[model samples]
Target: MNVLITGASAGFGKALAERLVANGHRVIGCARRLDKLNALADTLGEAFLPVVMDVSDTASIPQIITDLPDNFKQIDVLVNNAGLALGTEPAQNASLDDWMRMTDTNIKGLMAVTHAVLPAMVARDSGYIINVGSIAGSWPYFGGNVYGATKAFVKQFSLNLRADLIGTQVRVTNLEPGNVAGTEFSNVRYHGDDDKAAKVYDGFKTMTGDDIGDILLWLIESPAHININRLEVMPVAQTYNGLTIAKQDS
Candidate 1:
């Protein structure tokens, strides 16, 4: 399959891209970091194609979409993994720029890529879309604020897209992962405050990027007649709900 993954420079996107290529799938990766992407392409050889794109730039996306090579133009899978959480602060105290960044990437950018790809998928009637969301979409928390709201949009949008393509063979799947380790998420959220970011998964084992990547691969490789709509994965260190952390550190 010819696959397209955004935010493919690191974390889950990079993991997924590597795995797919290893399994003989051609992958086109887009991110703001051309240097890192080129590095990945070098490792994967012809299986990996790098496209420099910023999801937040509305003007640049359409042209990039059209410029895909003939082989990649008929993309069989699209992974909307290019998103971030900025500043773990309540809305009232949060920076407007942070909130806007989240909305732009998580909502507008998602829509832009989907709009550019879905039409072709619908016409082909044989493609899959995997949206990488967060458990925060369903269960909000302190400081989740706008990041949570954006993911909520992702959840509902995935469901609605599925409804709209009722008769078509196009499939939409949402993967909401919790407390993933080995990613740039915390760093981005804490705005490079390494100490605070490091504490997020300090005491416990967390899910790895490859774990989520593997789950996604399973969802796509399943029979065309079967559509796995949603899957939520959480690390074992954290149990159900608010039970996991109930301590006072004064």
Candidate 2:
């Protein structure tokens, strides 16, 4: 199968690319960092093709898809993994820029890429779209305002795609993972404050990119007739603590 993964420069995307290539499937890894993608290409050899892309840049996505080489043109699987959470601040105190950035990459960008790829999939009547969502989409947190909203959009979008592809063999799955560590996620969220990011998972054993990669492989290799709509994952160390209540002045 030919697989295309966005945000392939690091974390889950990189892990997925490596795993797919090792399993003898061709992978096109897309990201904005040419240097990192080149390094990944070197590591993964010919089986991995790196494409420079910024999902947030909606204007260029269609052209990039059109320019794909013959071999990688037919993408059997599309992993919409290019997304981020910019700030941990409450909505009232959050940066408007951060919200817009998240909206661009997580919502508009995913829609653009899916729109560009869905036609071929519909024509062929076979394909899979795996969206990397987050638990924050379903279970809200104190500082998870816009980021969670974007993921909620992803969750709903996946289901709606399924509805639209009802007659075709195309499948869509939303994978919502919680507390995943060992990724640039926190660092990016904290805007390069390494110490602040490190403290997020200080002593906890959190999910790794490999874990997500394994899940992706399983989803891809599952029976073509069976479509798993959604899968929510979290480390055993994590669980919902329920809603918080602040007592008003008495």
- Models, CA RMSD each: 2.9, 0.8
lDDT of 2 by residue, 5-111 (tens): 99999999998898898899999999999999999999999889989999989999999999999999999999999999999999999999999999999999999
Measured with C-alpha atoms, the lDDT of residue 214 in candidate 2 is 89
- Lowest lDDT sum, 10 consecutive residues, model 2, at 201-210
TM, every model: 0.95, 0.98
lDDT of each: 0.91, 0.94
Residue pairs clashing in model 2 are none
